[model samples]
Target: MSLSQQRRFPRRRTSVGASRDFVTGVLIEWQLHSLIEDIELCVSELATNALLHGAPPGREFSVGLHRVEELVRLEVRDSGPGQPVVQCPDDDACSGRGLRLVRALADDFGINDHIVGKTVWLVFKAPAAPAPAPAPLTTPGSS
Candidate 1:
């Protein structure tokens, strides 16, 4: 079965931590322990980006989680102009590497530009479902 959940956060700095917590809760509910770390990091980066650069004055952004079969998709949508890009900042630059992390950990990455804003999404390949336990071995003579 497929699963989906989403939340919208304001452009406040605290929203960054809130978004991380939100995603963590959802991942836990879905029993996706193996993916919590990477997904949390990605969500933090995206949410931070949205807060710092994407969210316009008095506007909010959204975070979404979706699972379909073996694939999980994470999305962050912001109502701001211009798309975010990964740039090679100077060594002295203390920031501007979040997208790079998203690119590295995510199995796939892409952005969808809408008329009003853009949605940056990351796709991860979920671990295969555990195989059912083998039927208990039995001897034909055993009643």
Candidate 2:
């Protein structure tokens, strides 16, 4: 198994897009293409929430990626005070949809509170291993 690496960035609304791109790039680096889209979506939404409502402007945030035996965990940490409340929305509600989407996409999701900020985690099953390379074909009429 590959070792896990983590990244931290400032908590700015504009950073949401950048964070998603960063996570996608990391997934490519680790050759985890199957989980790229799901992870990117989750990371983007969670990071957006952290920047928009979870914390104040100019505060810092973090993104951590861990690859275990059969799962990959994505976490977005922010220096915000409040915990994420996942509420089911009515048909007319316009807001409070991010966490719901998180729960839907992630196999398992949760929140963790730190001394200063909080971390939102989303976990998905790791992609199945790529099929082994096929053996070279032999020619019947080889020289």
Candidate 3:
């Protein structure tokens, strides 16, 4: 079965934490524990970017998660005009490395622009479920 959810948060510093918590709860509900760490990191980065560069004062940004089969897709939408580009910041730079980190962690990353905003998305392959334990060994004559 596929799962999907979305939430909108105001453009504020706290929204980044809220976004991470929201994503974490959803992944847990969907039994996607294996992806929690990477997903949370990505969500934090994207949400921070949205609050910093995309949403204007009093505006809001959104986060969405969709899981179909073995693929999980995450999207962060904001009222920004330009798409995010990956940049190799200097070793001492404290900022500008979010997208680069995302690119390294996610299987695929891209941006989709709408008439009014843009959505930065990351796609990840979910870890395979463990095999069910073999049925207890049975002897033909055993009860």
Clashing pairs in 3: none
| Shift in Å, residue 5, candidate 3 | 0.9
Which residues of candidate 3, in runs, are more than 4 Å off?
137-139
Cα lDDT tens digits for candidate 3, 56-136: 787999999999889999999998777788999999998999999998999999999999999999999998778899998
Local distance difference test values of all predictions, in order: 0.94, 0.83, 0.94
Where is model 1 more than 4 Å wrong at Cα? none
RMSD of each: 1.0, 2.9, 1.3
Candidate 3 residue-wise lDDT at 143: 100
lDDT of 1 by residue, 1-143 (tens): 89999999999999989999999999899888899999999999999999888899899999999999989999999999998998888889999889988999999999999999899999999898899999989999997
| Global local distance difference test of model 2 | 0.83
lDDT of 2 by residue, 8-83 (tens): 7686666888888888888898788988888888888888887787767777788889888778889888887887
In model 3, how large is the Cα lDDT of residue 42? 99
